[model samples]
Target: MTFVVPVHQQGQQQTTSEVGILNNDLSLEREGALGLLERRRNEVVNRDLNTSTTAVQRNQEENGDDENAKKKQQRSQCSRGCKKDWLGDGWCDSACNTEACGFDEGDCLGWCSGDCKPSWEGDGYCDAACYVAACNWDRGDCSRWREQGVDAVERRALQQKLRQFQQHRLQLPECKCERRLLVNGSCTPECNVPECLFDGGECLDMCNAKCSKSWLGDGDCDRECDTPECAYDKGDCASTTNATLQAMRKENGTLEVCDSTCRLWMIGNGVCDKQCNNAACGYDNGDCDNITAVVEIDYSVEPEAVYQFCAKEWIGDGHCDANCYNKPSRWDGGDCEGTEFEVEQAAKGIGPQYDQ
Candidate 1:
């Protein structure tokens, strides 16, 4: 029993066979095109390799040729006129003296046995003509006053070395000397010669001539000496009653003065004396709590009496009176017992029994 296909089914089967044949043809064509491309790539690679090898070989051959040519040139030059053996034979022969002979291959670096010419003796040129003894050593020109070496060139070099050595051997004046130590940027007592400017100006003023150690503590205050170099002339300028501060206040026309008292009695009084509130007075012996106001002093009363009066008035006022500082009474009604000033005084081993 054979099964027969319908007419429509038969046409579809025929169309499918044709399509399969066309696909096989396309696959074969694609493979052939790929093979051709691969062959072309291999050809290009092989050709490039060969070309690079050839260029490298050609460059090497060219370099070798150049070297051979240079060698031939040198050989020709060495063989002409002066043989290679005669070039450095220690004799400065006229035949081998040309530049082509390498200047006799440096064989003529020293004195030679050539005839001396009087005209060329002192011409300042170091040649065979002036190298002989009979030329009076080139009339003192070839060696330029340095004639002990093998040649003029070597002598000149030796002269330069001598100059450098002399320069290196030179020494500056020692600062240890009195003359140099005075200006040596440091203060020293040994150099304090008053005749020397300001005793070298270190122990005194560096610029002002008048500010010297000679006038530092002298009874009279030199206005120019009123500087740190002279310790502000403490002998005269320290007290407010001194002439310096008084004159300064008078110049300013202000009777009020900042009391920079150093005396223990003037510090820490109940009154905030203007001059007493400074470090020289132990910060007014710690009495300057309120700097906005300052109590006036009655000039008619004795200073000690005034202090006693002020101490009594400010007692037990929540502050210690400076005048009562470390006093036998430990004044101020014990207000200073726990204060910072009291602690500081205690640290300093100060007490009512100890005198300042």
Candidate 2:
């Protein structure tokens, strides 16, 4: 016979032997069956709980992997910012990390760490550090320094050194040294001066001197001079008549004097005046010849007997003149009256005398 037992064992475990006793003896089974059933129920419940816990853990791991992938995507999209392992380390002190201790929550962490330093600190030196906890201890970390209270002497020394450094930096080969200083405050090599003078100054040794006037320096004389002295004191003076005469004498051994006797002799010989025609007298002026001659011509027309005989038929014989006979006659003049007349004239005059 089966028996039902009521048991109130909550939050407790029952051993396998106890369960066996309840199943074997009906009296004991009735008494502890409920405990055994509760224990069995607890085991099944614990198993379901373990399975739920494992599923939750798995979900959490998956979520963690998704978060890591999102973080990697965010880092990759970070342009114009520091690409270091941390975010917010770009220009203008933008890199920041609120999670880190001693870092300003709203402030950029990239600015607080790494090679980036406070403005008050100069070139990573301790002397340039600000009077703060970060700067005084760890070389200006986690601190933004102010320049208001800097020592005047130290500032001056730093400025002087910076200027010198800048001047040295500007000494590049491409700078214009003579005209202006470079961006780095260094001077360039001097520029060379041109050889020619722009202000019309005296010519340099390499330049040749040019004269504006003839007879100046080695230039030729321009005009004639009638002075007694043949030479000119001033280099650019005009040529003298005596000098010209001497030059002429040197060119030609003898000179033909253009006196009154020479003029009379030229006129008596009927020659054109040399004074009127210099080209005919060796470029000199004297009396020359001017003679003329006369020519005669005849304009009378000679007669032709054949033309006269042919013209007589139209001119009525004795009325025909020498002009009519001299003129050309057409081949078909009238009829045989002219032909017979022409033949008779030709026989009478022993052939006509023709004018060419």
Candidate 3:
């Protein structure tokens, strides 16, 4: 009797197996054929692996030999599904510290030593540390000056304008809220904010001001607590010059009537007003602490016209935001590179032209 058998190789190109005809008595011939086919399969696998390795080498050469690049390569080695849950779970898996991941949800923050938050990619401030391919050329912040086609003259003028704007902004009125207090006499807030220190003990009610210790020395002069029995609001209102309104004392020793605005109109109004970024108004009822960015503001116009620049939705939607521009470590995800206007400039030879 005679038999014919087929041998399959585990390779994509070798889907069809080799066939060998054998005589029942000729076992030696069948063994030789099987061995030959096995060797052929091995060769195909080795070739495929070598080809993949060469492609990787070429990519590395183009990207340069940076630590981030190496980490990016490691991230590529693993599929997203493999590291899905662990990507941003507060544990910097060290293995998943690539930009493709969320920098381990900022858990690996100290590793870079410089600002490399994924959100800080294009926030206008050029981060020297993020000037690499892995970080998308710092999300285009470093090269945006040239890419936007600005000539030396324009660059100088724009820089001057920026400086002036910054100085002017500094002159703007800054409002502060009074710090909350606890039983420990420590200056802190009643909330769970670690940056401000949280008070665990029960609030102490004192001074016959119908208020707790947290409200006695609070910056805002509480009407009920302004009596001398309350030590004139624990001296929080000593400099309040407004005799009639008894308004809150501003940091500059002026009086700011915050009666209606701070309590009703501004707090919980869904706007993170700079004046409300303090304990007096519950930190704008938690709005000021949300993930927000100032994408655009025309300081050339009146400050009132552009006061509400920060918006929570602009941080991660993959668009280069104006507020995030030039701000180191305050990126707009990975969206910004150069401006469309700059691209136009490049065409006119007034600025650097990058290949699209």
Candidate 4:
């Protein structure tokens, strides 16, 4: 018996197997087709793995380049003395030294010299030497030493000796003079001198006087007034003279003995009469009666004729009035009370002048 078979093409065709399926039995054809499908699937999986590996390697290379660039930037910043944390990891301590730190040289030197502490040792004693040198330089005539015009080598040697002396002085327990005290490794001038002097004299005694009448007699003596009169006059002579005059006047006019006789009829003795009513004298022999007199006043309003005399020598009279407009009917008397529209119309001489 002869059999006819149909072939179906679905996708791209694969290479033909050495063992052909054309003349093969039904089971052999099925096995060949299965093997070809498995081989295509394996090729696809291997290609994907290779592509993924290449991508991972590229990413790693890029990451390494970024890290190297960051390190270079950090080094550049460190060179500029702008490192955020000088003591942190990867930071160079040499970049933050006295000369390279970009801070105040004196302050940085002092810090590096360990002058910030109460006591120092070895190289730390440099600040103390600087401090003593500064004190002696301030107090002594350093200009004299410069005037010698020593050579550069000798000058440098002398400077080194002075520095050494300063350091040695700093190592001492205490400064001999208060002015020698070092502030930031420099001496401060003494400032305890008195500004003014107090001399023991009469003026000083008068200045301390506590008498109440001193203000009226003589004022307190001071540097401005070093005399006795300044304290004795309590400063006011006019008021004291006026008070003395007033006392004399009161005694002579009001407190005098009355030698006049009383005119009262009911009095037993006209000598000691206490009911005297005379205007010239209110007392009889010595005692005076305390009687007060009342005076009456009238407060009535009366009309009086007021005569206004106008000068007949009129010079500029009626001159201003003739030119001035006193009545509203006059043209120059300003616009009469009217609405804004009417005023505007009158200003332009429209609509009957609006009564103004």
Highest-scoring model, lDDT: 1
Candidate 1 residue 236 Cα shift, in angstroms, is: 74
Candidate 4 segments whose C-alpha is farther than 4 A from its true place: 1-24, 80-356
Worst lDDT run of 10 residues, candidate 2, spans 191-200
Q: Model 2: per-residue lDDT, tens digit, 1-356?
A: 99655453431346666776777797666669888899999999999999999999999999999988876665555443443533432322223232321122224433433222343243332222132344443344212223333231122344364356466764323322222222222211121111111111111111112222112223344232111011121222333324544555466444344332222122211123333233322232221222111111111231100010222344334332222332243222323234444564456562234322
TM-score: the better of candidates 1 and 3: 1
Q: List model 4 lDDT by residue over 1-356, tens digit each.
A: 88654343322233254234554666677888899899999989998998999999989999999977865554554455445455332222333443333332223343322112112222211212112232332222223333443221122343354456467774323222222232213212111111100111112122223322113223232222221222213233334334443553465563233323322221211122333333323332222232122111111221111111112222123321111112321422332235454454456764434445
RMSD of each: 31.4, 49.0, 28.5, 43.8
TM-score per candidate, chains pooled:
0.23, 0.23, 0.21, 0.21
Candidate 1 Cα deviation (angstroms), residue 339: 99
- Name the candidate, 1 or 3, with the larger lDDT value: 1
lDDT of 1 by residue, 1-356 (tens): 99887999989999999999999998999999999999999999999999999999999999999977865565467636667776666555444565656666666555343323233455544332354465566666545224334442222343354345346963223222233344445644333322232233344322134554334344666655543323344344445334433453455442244342334333432335555666434455345554433444543452312222234446567877544553533455677777776776677777553555
Which whole-number lDDT from 0 to 100 does residue 180 have in model 1? 32
